[model samples]
Target chain A: MSSTPSLWRRPFLPARILRWPSGKATPASAVYEHPLIVRYCHWLNTIALFILAGSGLQIFMAFPSFGPKIPQHDLLHVPPKLALGGWLGGALQWHITFAWIYIATGLIYVIYQFASGNYRQFLFTSSDIKGVWPMARFYFFRGEKPPAAESYNALQKLAYTFVVLLGILSVWTGLVLYKPVQFSGLAWLLGGFHLARVWHFAVLWLFVLFVIGHLIMVILHGWNNFVSMITGWKRNPDYLP
Target chain B: MVEPTNNEKLAHHLARRDLLRLSPLLLAGALFIPSVRSKFITGGLGVGDWLSEAIFRRNHLAPTFSTSELTPFDQFPLNTYDVNDPDVDFDDWALTVSGDVARPGKYSLAQIKALPLQRQNTKHICVEGWDVVGRFGGARVSDFLNLVGANTSAKFLYVECADDYYESLDMPSALQPQSLLCYEMYDQPLTREHGAPLRFSLPTKLGYKSAKYLTTLRVTDVIPQKGYWEDQGYSQDGGI
Candidate 1:
C-alpha cells in the first residue's frame, strides 16, 4: 500500500480502513470509489446531455413526422415547456454547441478509464451475468440483498456498460443526420438518411429512459451513494467491510 | 504515527478540494447571463459552420436516386418565405451577372439555354428535416461561370431572387458538378410557383440556400448580407 499512489491504492480493499485522529476517535469506513476525473466528467456530461436532449425536442418540432412532407402525419406534439430553445434555429444552436462538449467529456472519460484500467470496476462481462439476476430480484421482487463484493453491483455494471454503448450509437446517428452526404457510408449502414433520423430520435428516448432509471436508483441508494459521485468518496458504503 | 486532529475536518477538506477541481465547469453556466447568451449562441453556430466548411468536399456529390424513387411532382412541397409567385416578366427577365466576372451584363435565357443540358435525380433536403427526391434539369453553374469568365478564386457566389429572397454560396459549393442554374423540374419547364424562368438546384446544400426566381448573380468576396434565413439566425454554411 505504501508503494502505491494514494488515489489508486487498493481501491476495492474494504478491509484497509482509515482511523480518525485522537480528538475524533472513530474508524471511518469509506472508499474512494470514483476518481476525480470520473466525478468531473459525470457532472459535466450530465449538463451537456440535458441541454442536448431538451434542444433536440425543439428541433424535432420543426418537422414532427417520419413520413413524406406532402401527406405529413405528425407522430406527437412535444410540449413547448419540455423544450429548451425557443425555435428550430435556436434549438440547433444549442444542440450543435453542446454536442461538442458532450463528445469531449465522453471521450476523455472513456480514455481515462481505459488508460488507468479503472474500467474493471464497472465494465460488464460474462462473469457479471449471473450476479445480475440476484440483484434485480433484490431490487424489484423483495429477494434478499446480495452481499456487496465490489464497488458497483452486477446490475450497476450492466447499466453503465449499456449506457456507454448507447452514447456511442447516438453520436454515430447524429453525425449521419448532420451530414448525410459527407458521411454517406455511415448513413447507409444506419439504413439511409430517413432511417438515420429515426434512429437518432429513438436513441434520445432511450437516453431519457436510462436517466429516469438512474435517478430512481440514486435516490433508493440514499445520500452516501449519491455523494460518492460528487466527492469521489463513499462514506459508510455497504460494500465497505 | 502522528495523530491527525479531527477526522471530520479532514474528510471535509478532501471533499472541498475535489469539488473545487470542477470550477472549470462554471464556464458553461455563463450561458445563463442574458448579455452573454446571444454571443454564446452565435459562437456555437460559428463553430458548427467552421466544422461544416472543413468537412465539405467539393468533389463529393449528394446521393443520386433512381427515377423510381422520385417524389411525385405534385407532392413536392413548394416552400417560400414570401409569395409563391413573384410574377416576373419572363420576356424582360435576364440574369444580371456582376462582380469579378469579365462579362458584367444581363445574359438572356436563350444564351443560358445554349449550354449543354445536364439532368439529375437528386434529393432536396430542408433544414426543417423533410427531404424529397426530384428530377431537375439545367446547365451546370460551372459552365455558366465559364461563359461569363468568372474569377474562380472568388470566395462566394451571391444571388438575389425576384421574390426578394437572397442567398449566398461558398465558391466551392457553387462549382460542384451537381450544382445547377435550373430552369426545369420533372422534365418540364418550371411553374410560376417553382421560380419559373430560373432557380438554383444545389443538391449539396439545404433547400433555403438554393434560392428560387434567380435575378442577379454576383461573384464576390464580401457578402454585405447573407441569405434571408441566415440573417434570421439559421446556419450560414447551410451545407448538408
Candidate 2:
C-alpha cells in the first residue's frame, strides 16, 4: 500500500489499453487537460452537489414515510419523525430549490463535455476493453506501462463515462418525478412518476461511491493533481530516462 | 549503491513490495469496498453546492424555485396559481372535493376559508439547500376531510389543480396533524401567482407534495397510487 501508487486501474478486465507515448520527442507523462472553463464548472458542480446533498437529507428528514430506514437515523441516530419537528416541510422546499441549481450545473457540464469533443478521450477502445491485464500487472508488479496514450486512461475513461451517463439518468428520472404536469412529456418519456424517483434515488448511491473513490485518488496523488484543478497550472514534473 | 533520485520509481518499487507484503489487507479491502469509503477520503477543495448535494437524495419530491443566492422571489399569495389563460381572476377561485365522500362540491375561497383556520410559523425546506421561516394560515386537511366526510374504504386523498397539476398521499399521510388546505401565507391571502385561492400541504412531505394551486380533493382507496414520480422510478411512499 505504501509503495504502490494511490490510484491504479486494477486491470479489472482482460483487455489492455493503449500504452504510453511510443518514441515520443517530448515527455512521456500525462498532460493536464483541466482548463479554466472546466475548472470553474468543476468547482461549481462540487459546490452545487454539496448543498444539494445536505439539504436533500433535510428534505428527506421532513418526511419519514417510506423504506425500512431513513438516512438521518442511520447517520445521527436521530429519527426524522422525532427530530424534524413541524418545520420539516419548509426545509424540504429549500432543499428543492437548491436541487434545481445542482441539476442545472450538471446540465452545463454535460453540454460542455459533449460540445468540447473531449468525450472522445473518455470513450472505451478495443485495447482498453482487452489489454487490462498487462496494464494491471505492469501497475501492480512493476511491469511496463503501455505506450503513451491520449487524454484519459482506460480506467479514468470508464469511470468518467459511466458517471456522465448516470448523471443523465438521474436527472431525467428526477424531472419526471418532480413535475408530472408541467413536464408531463418528461414523465411519460421516463415511465410514470414514482418509478422515476426510484431510478433517481438508486443512481444517487452510485455517485456517492464515485465521490468516495474520487477522494481517495486525490489524496494518494497529492497536491499536484488537486492544486492544478484550482489554479489550472501544474509545473510539469522533471522526467528522465 | 546510489538511491534512485526519482521518487516515483522508488515509490513504485516500494508499492509493489508493500502490495506483496500486504496481500491479505488488499484482498480484504477488495472484498469490502465500503470500509475504504468509510475512511473519509474526499476530493476537491472545501467549497460549494456539490458537497451539500452529495448528501441529498438525487430527485426531490419538492419544488425547485429560488435556486441561487442571485434569485429574487416574486412573492404573491401563499397558495398562488398562474392562471391558465391570464383571463381569470383568482379571488373567484374555489376548492372542489369529491370521490367517496358525502359531499362533492366546489367551495369558493371565502367558503373554504370561513370553515376553519390555523396559523403557525414554520420552516420551508428544499432538497437543493435553503430554508425560510414563514407563517402559514389555512384550514386543516383533516377538518375538510371531515366536512366532506371520510369513508372507511378510502385510503388516500388526491389533490388536483386547475392546470392539471396533481399529487396524492395515503389517507394517514394526508390526514396527519400538520396537513393543511392552506389559504393564507406569511400574512396574506394566496396570490394568483402563488398557488392562489388555496394549496395543499402535508408538512411531513417535500415541497412538491404541497401541491400549490389546489382546486379539488379526491378521496380513494388504492395501492400504488400514481403521482408524477410514481410513473418515473421514485417509490410511492416518498417518505425519505
Candidate 3:
C-alpha cells in the first residue's frame, strides 16, 4: 500500500458523554460517514433535480395536457412567473442542457454503487423487513430506541431505491417524449406518446414529493444528517461498543 | 514515517480546498436563477441548436409513411391569423419570387405544379405535443429555387404567407430535399383549412416553419425578418 494514511483513520471529535442514573454512558463524536463519491453524487443530483423541476414546469405550461381540443383552455396551468425559462424556447434550452448532466451523474452514482459494493447499504434483507414495525414504532415515539441500523434503516433504503427507480422512469419517459418517432418502440410500449408524456410529468411530481420528504427527514435528524452529507462524517453520542 | 491519519487529512483537505473550489461552481450555478438569467448563460441554447443542426443535418430525411397512414387532412389544425383572407383571390394567387432571384416575377399555381412534383407522407409535428402524418404533394423547394434562378449562395430565404405570417429558413434547410412548396394534400387540392394555392413544407422543421398560403418567396443573404411566432420566442431553427 502507499504511505498515505487510509481515509477512515482520521481522528474523530471527542465524544460527548450522557451519564445515566443506572451508570450507563453514551459517547457521541463526529465519525466518518459518506464517501466523497457519495457526497458529490448527492449534491449533483440535488442541483440537477431542482433545475429539471423548474424547467420542466416551464415546458409543461406550453401544452399543459392532453384533453378535448378546446383551443387554449387547457387545464392545470402554471403561471410563467412561478416557472423557470420564462418561455418555451428558454425552458427547452435549460431542460436539454441539464438533461445530459443529470443523466451522466445518475449513471455514475449507479456505477459507484455496484463497483464499490455500496449497494448493500441500500439493500434490505428479511431481517430488515422484520425490523420495520420496530423502527416505525421508534420513530413514532412508542419505543425508547430505534432498531440497529448500519448505513441506512429499512425505510430509508426503500425510499432511496424507489427514488432511483423513479429517476430511471423519468429519463425513459423523457426520451420517449423527446423523440417519439425515433424511439417509437419505447413510445409504443409506454402506451403511446401522450401516455409517455403523462408518465414523465407524473414522475416529476413524485420527485417533488420525494424532495419534501427528504428535507423533512433531514430536519428531524438534525445537524448530524446535514453535516454528514456535507463532510462525510457523523457524530453519534449514543455509540455502542 | 507516519503522517497524519487519512480521515484527518481528508477532513482537512475538504475543509480547506474542496469548499473553496465548489464555491465558484455554486456561484456560477446561481446564474441560472430566473431573475438573474442572462443570454451569456442561455447562449448554450443557441449552441445546442447549432450542434443539433450540425449532427442531424439539414438534409436529413424525416421518416415518411404510406398514404394509408396519413391523418385525415381535415384533422390537421388550421393555425393562422386569417383562415380565409378576403384579399387572396385564388385566380390571381401566385407565388412571387424576388430579391436575389434572377426570375423576379409571380409563378401561377399551374406553373408551380408543372415544375417537378415530389410527394411525402410525413409527420407534421407541432410544438404543442401533437403530430399528424399527412400526404403532401408539391415541388421540391430546391427545384423551385433553381427554376427561379434563386441565388443558392444566399444564406436565408424569407417566406411570407398570404395570411400575413412570415418565417426565414437557413440556406441549408431551404435547400433540403424534403423541403417543398406544396399545393396538394391527400391527392387533392388543399382546402382553405390547410395552406392552399401553396405552402412551404419543411418536414425537418416544426409545424410553424411551414408558412401557409404563400404570397412571397424572397431569397436573401441575411435574415431580414423573423417569423410571427419566432418573434414570440419560438426557436428560429424550428428543428425537432
lDDT of 1 by residue, B1-240 (tens): 776679967998988875567554666667789778788877888897999889889898888999899999999999999999999999999999999999899999999999999899998989999999999999999999999999999999999999899999999989999999999999999899988799999998889997999999999999979999999889999888
Against the true structure, candidate 3 has what lDDT? Answer: 0.75
Per-model TM-score on C-alpha atoms: 0.91, 0.43, 0.75
Model 2 lDDT per residue over A111-226, tens place? 76556555465666676766566656664588877663543456656777787787778667765544443354676676545455556656767878989877875684467667
Candidate 1 chain B: 10-residue stretch with minimal lDDT:
B18-27
The candidates, ranked best first by lDDT, are 1, 3, 2
Runs of candidate 1 with Cα error greater than 4 angstroms are A1-26, B1-25
Q: In model 2, where do residues sit more than 4 Å from their true spots?
A: A1-32, A65-87, A125-127, A131-148, A188-191, A237-241, B1-240
Q: How well is candidate 1 docked (DockQ)?
A: 0.60
After superposition on all CA atoms, what RMSD does each candidate show versus the true structure?
5.2, 19.9, 6.8
How well does candidate 3 score on lDDT at residue B20?
A: 60
Native contact recovery (fnat) for each candidate is 0.64, 0.00, 0.14
Query: B92, model 2: CA deviation in Å?
Result: 22
Count clashes in each candidate, considering only residues at least 3 apart in sequence or on different chains: 0, 99, 4
* Deviation from native of the Cα of residue A190 in model 1, angstroms: 0.7
**Chain A TM-scores of all predicted models:** 0.90, 0.67, 0.82
Q: Write the per-residue lDDT of candidate 3 for residues A51-146, one digit (tens) a residue.
A: 788888888887786752334457698866768777777777677667776787799988877666566666565767776776677777667566
Which digits, one per residue and each the tens of the lDDT, describe model 1 over residues A1-241? 4677555443533323444444544456677778878888888889889999999999999999999999999999998999988999889988988888888889999998877768878789899999999999999999999999888899999999999999999999998888888888999899888999899999999999999999999998999999989877788777655
